[model samples]
Target: MEYQWNFAPIFAHSDALLVGALGTLRIFVVCLLLGLSLGLLVGLARYSTRRLLTWPAAAFVEFFRNTPVLVQIIWFFFALPILVPFEISPMTAAVLGISLNSAAFSAEIFRGGIQSIEPGQWEAGRAIGMSYAQIMRRIILPQAIRRMLPALTNRGIEIFKMSTLASVVAYVELLHQGRLIASLNFNPIETYTVIAVAFFLFLYPLVRATYVLERRLGRSD
Candidate 1:
C-alpha cells in the first residue's frame, strides 16, 4: 500500500507540538541541572577517603550505570507508588527518573575526568597547604570540568533523546504529542517524521557544541 505524504497535519497542530516540545525541553534542562549537581557530589563522594561515604556512592553509580534507563523509568513510574504508597505525577516521575539515572553515568564521567588530572597537580595544591575541599573546588574541579565538557554535552544529547520515554508515563512530550496526532489522523509517517526532525533540531546544536569544545581543548592541550 502506498502511503500519502501530508505535512499539513503536523503543521496544523504546531501549537500543541510547540507546547510539548517546550515541556520536553524544560524537563531536559531541569534534569540536566539536577543530575549534573548530584553527579558532582557523588563523584566527589566516590573519591572520598572514608569508605563509608565512598562505598555508597560507588554502589549508586554501579547500579544505575549497569541497569537500563528504561527499566529505571518503569520502576519509578509503576513500582515506586506500589512500594512507597506515595503518588507522584507522571511528569515528576519522568524528570526524577531521568535525573537520577543520568547522575549515575555522569558521576563516572566526572570521576574519570578527575582521575585523569596529573598527580603533580594534587601535590602542588597540598604543598601550598590547600585543604582537600579547597584543592578540589579551586584547582581540580575547574580543570576537570573543562576536560569533561565534551562528554557532558554528549550526555546532554542522550538525555534529550531519552526524554521521549516520558511518553510511557503519560507525560506529553514531543513524541507523546506526535503519537497522539498519529492516532487521531492515522498518519504515522508524517507524525514520526516531524518528531524525528524536532529531535534533530534539539540535539544537533549540542553535537556541534561538543565538537567545537573538543577542538578548542585539543588545541590548548
Candidate 2:
C-alpha cells in the first residue's frame, strides 16, 4: 500500500507544539543558570585545600554524574512527593534532575578551567596583597570564563537536546508534544521528523558559535 505523508494534523495543533518548544527552552535556560551557580560553588569546594569541603562536593558530583538522568527525574517527580508535604510537578522534576546532572559536569569544567591558570597569576595576585576571594573574583574566574565559555555553550546545547527527556516525566517538551500529536494523527514519522529538524535548526548555530570561539581563544584543546 502506498502511504500518504500528512503534516496538516500536526500543524493544526501548532499552538501546542510552540508551547512545548517554549517549555523546553525555559527549562534549558533555567538549568543552565542553576548549573552555572551550583557548579561554581561545587568546583570551588573541589579545589579547596580543606578535605572537609572537598569530600561533600566530590560526593555530590559523583552521585549526580554517575546516575542516569531518567532515574533522577522519575525519583524527583514520583518519590519526592511521598516524602514532602507538597506535590512536585514534572517540569520542576525535569529541571532539578537534569540541572543537577549538568552541575556535576559543569563543576568539572570549572575546576579544569580554574586549574589551567598559571601559578604565577595566583602569586601575582598575592603580591598585590589581594585576598583569596579577590584573586578568585578578579583574576581566576575572569580567565576561567574564557576557557569555560565554549564548553559551557556546548553544555547548553546538550541541555537543550536533553529537554526531550522531560517528556518521559510527562513534561511536554518538543518530543512529548510531537508524540501526542503523532498518536492523535497517526503520523509518527511526519511528526517526529519535524521535531528533529526543528531541534537541529535551533541547535546548529550554538554549536557553530562555540567552535568559532574555541578557535579564537587558542584553547581548542
Candidate 3:
C-alpha cells in the first residue's frame, strides 16, 4: 500500500498553525526567563554557607531533576487546586512544569560556573569591605556569568525544544496543533513531515549558535 501526501489540509489551517507556533515561542521565552531568575537564586543558595539555604536548594534541585516533567504538569493542572487556594490552568501548569524543571538543571550549571571563579576573587571583595550581596553583584556574578554564557544559552535552546510537552496540557502549541491536524485529516505522514521541517527550521539555527558560542568560550577557557 502507498500513502498519498497532501498539504492542502495544512495550508487550510496555516493561520491556526502560525498562531500555535507563536504561542509555543511565547510560552518558551516566558518560562526560560522565569527559569533564569529562579535558577540564579537557587544556584547562589547552593553555594551558601548556611545549612538552611543549602538544604532547601538541594532538595528543590533533587525533586525537580528526578521527577518527570509530565507528572509535574498533570499534578499542577489537576491536583493543585486541592492543596492551594488558587486553581491552576493548563497554560500555567505547562509553564511551571517546564520552567521549574529547567531551573533545576540551570541551577547546577550556574553553581558550576560560580565555583569555577577563583576563590581570590571573593577574598578581594572582602578585602574591599564589601557585603556578601555586594561582592556577588559587583565582582563575582559578572565574571561568573561570563564564564557560563555558553552553557546558559544552550540551556535556553533545550528549554525551547522541551516546550513541545505543553501539548499534553492542551496549550495549543506547535506540536499539539500538528497532532490535531493529523488526527483530523488522517494524513499523519504529511502532517508530521511538516512538523519536523518546522522544528528543524526553528531549532537548527539555535543549535548552530550554540556551537559557535561554545567555540568562542573554549578560546577564552
Candidate 4:
C-alpha cells in the first residue's frame, strides 16, 4: 500500500502558520538590525590599535563564534534568568542569542571588508585633512560595502533560517506552528513538507540576489 497525501487538514490551520510566520519575521528583523549594527562597532574595535578596545572585542567574537548558537539561546533562556532580576522571555532570549552570534560572524565580515582597502586610500584621506571618521564614512565604507554585499546577504539568509531555532524554546515560529498542526492532524509529512516549501520560497530569492550581487560586483571591481 502507498501513502496517501492530504493537505486539506493543514490548510485548515493556516491561521496558526500565519501567526508563526509573523513571529519568525519579527525575530529576523530585530536580530538582523541589532546584529549588523553591533557588528560594525565590534569590528571597528577589533580593528583598533588600542588594547582596551581590541581585547574585549576579540574575546566577544571568539566566544560567540566558537560556541553553538543553540547553546547560547538555551543559556540566555534558562541560565541568565537565574542570574538576573527580571524574567527572560523566549523572544528576548532568541533575539540575544541570534543577534550576538550574527554579530560575531558579521564582525569578521566588516573587519575584512574594511581591511581590504589599500593603505594608500587612508593616506590620501589624511593628506586631504580628513578625520578618521570622515575618511571611513566618505572613502572606505562605501567601497567596502559593495564588496561585502554578497557575504552580508548570505548572513541575512542564515539569520532567516536561524529563526526556526526559536521553536526549541517554545517561541512560536513557522516550524513550531507546523509541529502543532502536525500533532493535531496527524499529518507530519504533509505539514513538514509545506514548511520546507515555505522556507524555500522565502530563501530562494535571497540566494538569487546574492548571485546577482556577486556578478555585478565582479564586473565593477
Candidate 1 lDDT score relative to the true structure = 0.88
Cα lDDT for residue 9, candidate 1: 77
Candidate 2 segments exceeding 4 Å error = 1-3, 211-221
User: TM-score for every candidate vs. truth?
Assistant: 0.93, 0.93, 0.90, 0.95
Give per-residue CA lDDT, model 4, range 101-139, as digits (tens): 999999999999999999999999999999999999899
| Error at 21, model 3, angstroms | 0.6
Where is model 3 more than 4 Å wrong at Cα?
Answer: 209-221
Q: lDDT by residue for model 1 over 1-221, one digit each (tens)?
A: 98769899779999889989998998899888988899989988887789998999999998888887777777888888888867978887888788888999899899989998998999999999999989999989988988898789878888888899889988988998999899988899999999998899888887887788778777756
The superposed Cα distance between candidate 1 and the true structure at residue 41, in angstroms, equals 1.0
lDDT of 4: 0.93
Pick out the ten consecutive residues of candidate 2 with the lowest summed lDDT. Answer: 212-221
Q: What is the C-alpha lDDT of each candidate?
A: 0.88, 0.90, 0.88, 0.93
Q: Using lDDT as the measure, which candidate wins?
A: 4
Residue 26 alpha-carbon offset, candidate 1, angstroms? 1.0
By TM-score, how accurate is candidate 1?
A: 0.93
